[model samples]
Target: MGLLCYGSVGGVMASLILVFSVMWVGGVGGVGFHERGSVMKWSGIPTALSLFAFCYSGHSVYPTIYASMADKTKFSRVLFVSFAVCTINYGVMAVVGYLMFGQATKSQVTLNLPVENMSSKIAIYTTLINPLAKYALIITPLVNAIEEWLQVSKSRFIGILIRTVILISTVIIALTVPYFGYVVALTGSFLSSSATMVLPSLCYLKIFKSSRRWGLELVMILAILVVGVFIAVIGTYVSMKQIVSSL
Candidate 1:
């Protein structure tokens, strides 16, 4: 776990450096920060919102992380720090990527990188490794749930087999689907939004119903819930429409 975190951080930093370098090292094989993109494209907003939701997809494993923390009171602080660091990292990457590639930027920024540059190569390799490093951590909770449901939690062989099957299934799905961007958007809209925004708010309201009244906090949570539902519905609809049309 420690090594995974360290390697991911290094990969992220390396990618960021490579992106920044692209701004100066122009004309090698990729576009420079020269294209002036439009102010806003309202048509793309739904997909963009879904992708943004994907950035906070860690909600599923958050409970496990909080439970494992020895210092329970500091969970909020830890979550805040984590979100802040991630937001800064993601925001910087998004801005740098847009500035570097502008209109030519593909959904996958690595694809727009100068293929021959050493920095680009480093960034590409690190980006590949970073996700692989996180795959287990992100899905472990789900895997554990499956094991328990199947009454195989105590069976080492069964657990390994289940994990292997899941891995293979995911790999096959990834390879089979050409519309991964749409799929990601759907996952974010349908799952991440529910987990991060809808579920948390509902859980809070349910648990605190006895003590809480119709006050500002209740209104705030309800507002969040409405926003979550809107994003989920609209984002999912747009992404699904695109996927169906492309097919």
Candidate 2:
């Protein structure tokens, strides 16, 4: 995890491994058209929308990546490259998984892979590594935010404590949540959607109020804000309904 977070090489290698493993599963399969299902269930729309929002919710770590860059001017390039790679990875995985299992596809693509296949094992192993590799990136910003809120900067130990506390709380939530699908949908709808889509647009408008307040950018951002809110509201309703129904 440390090596992956602190070094460029590790991230690249891990990403390549992920991409290859996923593609390998697809390549070895001759999934029937039955697997490539023709119908979509209307009930799954909210879950699908929320999960897509979750997939792209990396905005929290953008500032850290930007500040750490040696050449800040290339930050745009970095974003372009990162988004491109993510798009490819996500696109391929979605296509392959749908082709393989269609409506039956699990959130963990490896779960849909044939358990007897070597490619399935590799993909599953790679999935385990991915969260560990990204743990630092995921936690750093949150830790910083907490520390800043408390104005506790003098002690690195305090930051570690905060991280530990947060991790422990997360574990408790995981154990108590009862269902992973509910958790994912709820987080994506409320937290990820707000952070990734709603907050940024509002912040941009607020910050640039004296500048391009009424330009083409405003129109685009407003459109995004509306769509984001709609997703958040409908997704949250569906997710909450599922959770209550299960209970």
Candidate 3:
């Protein structure tokens, strides 16, 4: 199920890239699709690169991958290979996309992607091929939460009910929220800072007695936390500006 979900995400990303390429070739341009009042202001390329780095921040699955492996030494080897492939692919795409669309790459890429507009035939086919994929994406975390709360008393029926309620609540909130990016940025700020930076370093420092090595790791972690906080602030401010402008 996890593998299938990963495959679907990869497919979606590939399809979006293809769509971006098409739009670039078709000469579409501009940041018109971004929410109103989004500031284009930035210090320089360094800031632009920092924002671009956020897209690569979803490396949380690395621990799961490492846990699944039988041989621990293979972890570094696997990571190196995987990182190389991802870096090459992302770098090539970014360069090609930038050259093709220049400053409009991000907007063009987001606007041209049309997964929501999938044809009925394709949607039906995907439903048949991966019947549980979409439901699992929405429901799995809810199920886990229910299991945590109910302990051994939780049943499949209970899980399903919990999942349904959560799904409904999410849909309602999504509908009510005027700007999703704002919600995303605010939530992401909290999650990214703690998960990516703060908590990990704390865990390592407390659990591992390797003081010298852990000190360096703590430094790196603090750096990440600082940057994460900065980005989150900027994202939240921009989102608020957008909301105010719309009103």
Candidate 4:
């Protein structure tokens, strides 16, 4: 479980760095230090900062890890080690990606990179690893939903049936929508906000009685909620526009 969790987090961090780097160089304005062609609009530094913050928000996984720990006494030590490892891994990848892409590290960096180049290997790995990781992630939620349904009805057969149905539905959707990234992004943004921000704050408030410091936490939670909403709204709008324009 630890290894899987580490790999999952590490892979995600590497993939995100590549994604943001590609976006930055592709005029997405996140990491582009060069002030070229109206960087004042969506291309500004604020957008870049937001993108970085979003990427670093992977730290939200710590609470889940801590919660699942059998030995709570070693929780802090475990977290420190895990975080250090993840940070080092992420930092190395980000640096390499930045160096490899130089100025053109936009969102689709992998597609633009030469397959013959060594850096392109990272792109390939990112492409392959991300979907597998996403599959694992989606399955967890699906399985939990099935388990809950079964528990509520005390019917193991019903759980199995529901699981089968979900698996079939997923396959059908995957086949119907050749582009699954949009689906993943939509679900990720919504769930990430809830799991990482709102739920954590609530848990802290309830467990620790941090009402005095709750103001700041509440503000941060609200910010995350707003960002999640922004991502969802803008993503939907842009996708719709693209589909319309293409038609």
Candidate 5:
């Protein structure tokens, strides 16, 4: 956000958002698409599914955003719309990007873009400023929760101290981790799966008190919970092994 204070980062981001699809498509065309005629490894399915879980993990922010919405009843509608948009955007990017680069794709797709291409430069520039914009939003909830639990003062000094400490701790951890992408994938696999899929189902099962234990609805939810836990445990182990090997 500091960049927004002194530069046209917001405008640039807006422009990028507006043209991102077009640019992705055009850039894919310009760079050329190739088919490897190869199959994805079965061993990679867990990590791939975990990454998809991360993509759908916007549910974590729903409570905060919903609280700020003017029409509370319309929250479900807003969620549907948001996810629909995201599905389209992510689907297009995934399909086009994969078709364009195939198995050669990197964790950050833009990094796979041709170095000489303007599209690549724009992608790199957008990426540079994205973290600045995302940092506050990502950390604010955790900070607020911690402050509330500790009954910390709402004063600016206390707030700044808390945010700074949290930021520094995360930065330190990130610096220590050699493969940032693997760490993200691991987190998404373990934490995001529970947050996005398991908890919600369990919460619903508990809150509604469904009497039919053998009913299809209950059975499906039970299956989801089991699968979620399985994925979390297995995925974390796999990701940790990969991270260790990288080191």
Candidate 6:
């Protein structure tokens, strides 16, 4: 829908749709986690890290969004606002969802809802449709990049072919893996750490080369990179191990 409509307006509508859907999740009151399973364990660290990385993985599209912005200099402010909104939304969902399902929460929270209920039915349909609505918007950059690389931007036939191939490939991968949580963890661990954590810090250091060498900022940036690399390595190992075992 966003791709069919104006990009900016469609984006807003998509976001609004999500906001309304989330309200239903919280409004359908939850049973507290009384007599529930254990709340914390040391074994959850890697999965927790993977989820955090996934939440912050929007950086891959920052360049495209910045290019579309009217004022590039205000991009940082816009990005900050975006992250803040996402953080609040995720926080609320996390609390409400955990309260509702406790230890039994599914990878996709919608799965936890009662399928027979009307509201759950609505949510399930909306959730299913939401991805289709945003699919074009999400893949436009990749498709354009491929067209540009192949110098086929003017060839409508080639453009369609490229998109079709990419879509088919994506479906094949999804079908092959079939495990939602494992795929999320694998992607977040293998790719998102570099995009969301390491590269930004390294870019900052490079851009601000005039700053005092061996300063606190440099140390902190290096530390961030190190931590990112550590997480990526460990998280990928964990995810791969889990994937292999599931096979």
Of the candidates shown, which would achieve the greatest TM-score relative to the real structure? 1
Tens digits of per-residue lDDT for model 2, 166-237: 888977986787867777888899888998899988888778775356777778898889978977999999
lDDT of 5 by residue, 1-247 (tens): 2332234335335434634733554556376555454566788877877777777776645666667666789988977876786677677767666767788877777767766766667766767666666566556667778889888857778889998999899889978766766887798888999997889887887888863467888888888888788768888888888888887
Task: Tell me which residue pairs clash in candidate 6.
Answer: none
Model 5 CA deviation exceeding 4 Å by range: 1-29
RMSD of each: 2.7, 2.8, 6.8, 6.9, 3.9, 3.1
Provide TM-scores for the models: 0.87, 0.86, 0.59, 0.53, 0.83, 0.84
Give, for candidate 3, the lowest lDDT window spanning 10 residues: 29-38
User: What is candidate 3's lDDT per residue for 1-247, written digit by digit as tens?
Assistant: 4554585465545544444444444344332233233235464333343334444445465565565567879988976875676676666655555544455544334343334443323433433444243445435544665678888344778766776787789779867876544455445554554455556656766787674364766677667667765655665465456557766
Q: Which pairs clash inside model 5?
A: none
User: What lDDT tens digits, residue by residue, belong to model 1 across residues 142-220?
Assistant: 8988998998999999999999999999899888988777889888898889988999898998898752587788889
Instruction: Quickly count the clashes in candidate 5.
Output: 0
Q: Which candidate is the best by lDDT?
A: 1
**Of 1 and 3, the candidate ranking higher by TM-score:** 1
Question: Model 4, range 1-247, lDDT digits (tens) per residue?
Answer: 4545666775667666565544444343333333333324453333333333344455444555566667879987876876676576557654545555545545444654556544455656767677666454446555655577657447777767776887789778878764333344444444544455556656665787565365876677557657655654554454444345545
**Per-residue lDDT for 72 in model 4?**
78
Candidate 4 is scored at a TM of 0.53
* lDDT by residue for model 6 (1-110), tens: 22343654445455555545545655653423332556676677787788779877866466676777667899889878878977876777676667667778788878
lDDT of each: 0.78, 0.77, 0.53, 0.54, 0.72, 0.73
Model 4 worst lDDT run, 10 consecutive residues: 30-39
- lDDT value for candidate 6? 0.73
Ten residues in a row with the worst lDDT in model 2?
A: 1-10
Residue pairs that clash (backbone atoms under 3 angstroms), model 2: none
> How many residue pairs clash in model 1?
0
Point out the worst 10-residue segment of candidate 5 by lDDT: 1-10
